[model samples]
Target: MGVFIHWAGTAALLAQLAGAAVAWGADGGADGVVAVGVEEFLGSTGDSAEQLLRLDLDRSGTLRAREDGVGGGWRLRGSSSAGRIDGALLDAQGAMVFNNHYADADLRDNVHAFADDVVTAITQGRGLAASKLAFVGSREGRRQIYVADSDGERIQQVTSDAALKGSPSLGPGGVLMAYTSWQSGFGDVVLKDLRDGRERTILSAPGTNSGAAFSLDGTRLALTMSYQGNAEIYMASVSGSRVRRLTHARSVEFSPAWGPEGNRVVFCSDAGGGPQLYVVGRQGGAAERVETGYRHNTSPEWSADGVHLAFTGRQGGGPAVVVHDLASGQNRVLLARGEEPTWAPDGRHVAAVLDGALVVVDSVTGRRRTIVRGFSEIREPSWSR
Candidate 1:
């Protein structure tokens, strides 16, 4: 059985910042903190367009989620190319808190971003609406990488390679993706720029070269290569310059996940008699085994706060997604029917492939939901920054 642990300090800080709201009293008047109504969104703001562009509370004031039990679910009613948006903000009480006119070309993305910011302001929770996911799907007859919104709304193909391609991982800031492809007749680590749809070969070593993950700052990458006679972990800059070997063990090392601060990395290795998660410093050091009760563990992913490690755990039945708390030495299984778990930007949710479809689970509430379906088979779904 996994032990329960209290939330860390960072989460507490976020709560304090986000829940700093002031509600109204029985007198139908302003109390200690002024409560802004939905009318603020209309009526005589000369710089309404500018306020919509800023989207910050200081520029347009905060709004509640509902007012008079009429309208809720803050949204961007309309927008244009001038960076203007007719936006809404709400508080935890479902009261209308703020609204303004705004302009922007990509209204959908802007609305999601603003919605996330609003949610952060009201609930102290990290906003993941603007985030995305990258995964491998065999829907096109061959394994290929694909991209989708965090909620699995916009499913788009990232690579159209008619060859074997898998192990998709998103780079820092969600601007790039690195995956292994056999289009060149051998396993090679390929980097694809998601911004402009550009592709480049990062590592085409003689032997197997796969399992690539980006560092926190997107400056470096950690991947496994057998060019040195054994499958080992290596670190290289994003430019493919300044290459350095990290692990020299005889056991195969792959699935390199950089810690939040980028000072250390967690990877799967058989150095301890079987495949298990191991942590080593980025510079170089002796690897220490991560304590867990499972007989086998692999596909480890480090949380953004550097306090948790999520990976696949197997006992006698099948594989399950498990999260281990680093600070308290406590671990918990997040999902009993999934693999290749990846953390969202908020660090509160994890996405994995379950029953050949993409599913997401809440780490705190234990709520499971399917985000993407209809794929013949999807694997290695990675959430972007």
Candidate 2:
């Protein structure tokens, strides 16, 4: 069973400066005091747009299940160019007991089918990282990104470059993150591979580019690009090439999120007046408004089962997390004052930013607990495969 751990520091609010200090370590000086830490002991802002592109996921058949080396399970590494897929199933000796290959496009459909084939043919029945969650955190300071156990433990920061970073979204295996950072002193989108901390510049513009949503198949990405002018939705090949603008207008449109079906995108747009929820097709068409008269409602996230939509907005006392059921047309408030609601892959509960820290709340019971805390500012979180 997973459990929540509370980690707190005696450092008072007046000592908040120490938060950044220990996070940075002034001259590597100052005797180590009780530095503030995340309760989970883990381990955002802004926009920039330029024709400027930086990081990318490499979608042009850059990778597939390897057919040679050691296979059975899809453990293929990412590639930048097309090549024969090679892999194998390893015993204790790391020898190739299983291996094969097909054209990349041929095995693209129903990715899960191949995954299951591997699991059943090899490991009996074990799920891939498909059931994982990943997010960026400042828990260890310096704006480093971290991946943790589903319950937020075993926290590991994948990036330590110390550049301001935020808006991390998980791809197929949850082993990579697409985010915006100031590493170049200019806002740029980059893809960070969690395995080795290697980064690829995907999109870097003058102002800001963020909100990367991986397609259900993990073959494409839907994101908000401000390079042209005001933020608009666009489709980009995962490899960072072939960027196709999907929206064209003067209104502010951003925070593009992929629907469970993978063919639609739900995002927050002021196009509806005061920033309301809107849904558009993956191919980009007339956006349909989902709400009215709420003054403010942003962050539309579809549930795991695609039955409900959870978002944050001020419908009452303060900003709250609201779930909208599509079939029954029911509106349920999961928690008040919640920001960045990321549904667990299983949809059993949602990990939300509550009271300025990462918290998980029961969708039905409304009970909540702080899983990550003690940071100067915490916001804009995403879930992984």
Candidate 3:
């Protein structure tokens, strides 16, 4: 076999690590080597609730989750089982000869291998920690909620139970949050006060109620309700109880995002055959096409300055996060593979769901990095207003 052992597979990972080191007589010799072993825990259920989140490892060449010799809960906890060391020497031939050393049952060998792959992964595209963010995730087979810093620090589970909860949309000034919860038989929108940790029910109906967004002045809220049959946009006073429908369409029109101007709202509709982006006046009026191209433009989020609108689009190829420039009437693809493109409060960057992980991106630079490798699926990551 070759000096350096390169093995990658869903089941071949563990065997290769242990086998590689022993073959090179790296068990215990003159020059010891660096080794590493790493394991990841996916989401697990009732007694064990049965919520299981698949590990979506983003790797190109040859990468797969190793399940042999590792057994436990939803975690990357395991012992370092194997090790191998490789070095270069000045041989007689002008070319450098690669030497391979293998260690038998070395604790450090697995760690060394882990480190090599981890470093290589980061250099590829995985970002280093920076800012913090709070999102919802399911654990132990239950649909709970969590808040983690943007860098995956201080991860705290906010809600504990089997009921579904998430879509933590921010308010105008970052003082409040509007989210949806299925604690009841139907989905209900709730307004949360960030200061005193108080929550109040804003709206509830018979159908799916979602996409709660606060207006610019923080005086009113725009959400989507399906009480009238199909989902439609609605405007409700921030502190008052009066609610009015903004659209009377017969199609499934929801996901209302308030525009920066505070006088208009953009939503997604399938009235024209496939799903597309549409705009309507705040008080209610005829809807206009805001974006064109794909029939699957959904989850519209207005930029802070309201110059552009970002939404999800699915062409024949795959799903992508795109931005629609209002003046130019052009659609720009920000991410080649992602969904739910939500603009930050500053509107300079976007937080999108890429490969089942949330990633922050600088739209102009076309660069992205992972936030953390947690959660089964992430959607509707809104910025703190």
Candidate 4:
């Protein structure tokens, strides 16, 4: 285990003192770690109904539920053949907490929402069971944006641009995705509303416009554009107005990731003679280099807790997933042979491209498991919040 410290100046110091810093340690068994063992919690339900959620689904799309970790079986909560339950919540005695209905084709997604509520109630943590992932998959002879469950099930293509697409980032609520596409013969930033099938070209200047990343509030986006004759970092409202340049460097900048508090942005730039990590104010100012001692680093992503950042870095050979602890000022490899690291809502597991497929790995336990594959290639995975 190796630790590297680089003070990010007064702003970073203030943020750390405000309780936004994340402490990093070599011990993988920390008590603060969130363990998302769906098989353990769901498959090994205890006799208590106080902190568990029971679910039952059949081939007919009928669903039932229970609360409090009861193992007796599911209650006749609802049914859906052509429609689906919009939302659901249950209390300890298998009683209704909340429920809604939806007449849409995305029945599974609706169920996921309800499950998320149940998990939150039980663990008081983000529901990894219900979170989603957005990535670029070349399944149809062209790279396009695809969405799937965090487990990589229920995969569906969200774009058919018949061109290249990459860098998919989920918005604040996981309700939208911003990505880059080459449908216009030049790189363009596009937004897709996940709730409804609506698409909007957010940035399409004469030059390259790519690497779209959404702030924690979903109100602003940080991306890379070359419209000013050089690749620079820019921030803009989701509506495409109030565009502000954040980095005015001569060296090219790309892959801007919004910090957890939405006040800072970390990105990749060659201003340090090699592609390296840099952090700057979201409003734009001097860029501070992240002294990782690596030859290259890119694809920066902030953990949900804002305590750590994950990016691609390697001294040689292929890039690997690296996590930098904001609190401890330490960085370490999470995955030995993966890149494009994106954090699960719990911030314990990371989704990355490994061997031409998408895999989720527990950074603490060092457990690596494949989520999905079979496409010609899958890269740039963005786990939903």
Top-scoring candidate (lDDT): 1
- Greater TM-score among 2 and 4 belongs to 4
Please provide, for model 4 over 1-385, each residue's C-alpha lDDT reduced to its tens digit, 9 standing for 90 to 100. 1233344555455553332122111111244322111211211212121122233111001122322222222222434443354344443234565566544455555555555654455446566656778988886477777888776778988887567778888985678888887888888888889889798888898798888888877888999998889999999888775589999988989999888788999999998777999999977889888777789888989887888889999787888889988777798888888989998877677889988999988776666779889999888888876
Residue 366, candidate 3: C-alpha displacement in angstroms:
1.5
RMSD (CA, Å), each prediction: 11.0, 19.8, 15.8, 13.6
Candidate 1 stretches with Cα past 4 Å from truth are 1-104, 122-125
Error of 2 at 260 (Å): 1.1
- Lowest lDDT sum, 10 consecutive residues, model 2, at 49-58
Evaluated against the true structure, the overall lDDT of model 3 is: 0.60
Off by over 4 Å in 2: 1-130, 139-141
lDDT of 1 by residue, 301-346 (tens): 8988788999999987899999999888788989887898999877
TM-score of 3: 0.63
**Residue 332 deviation, candidate 4, in Å?**
2.2
The lDDT per prediction is 0.72, 0.60, 0.60, 0.70
TM-score of each: 0.78, 0.64, 0.63, 0.75
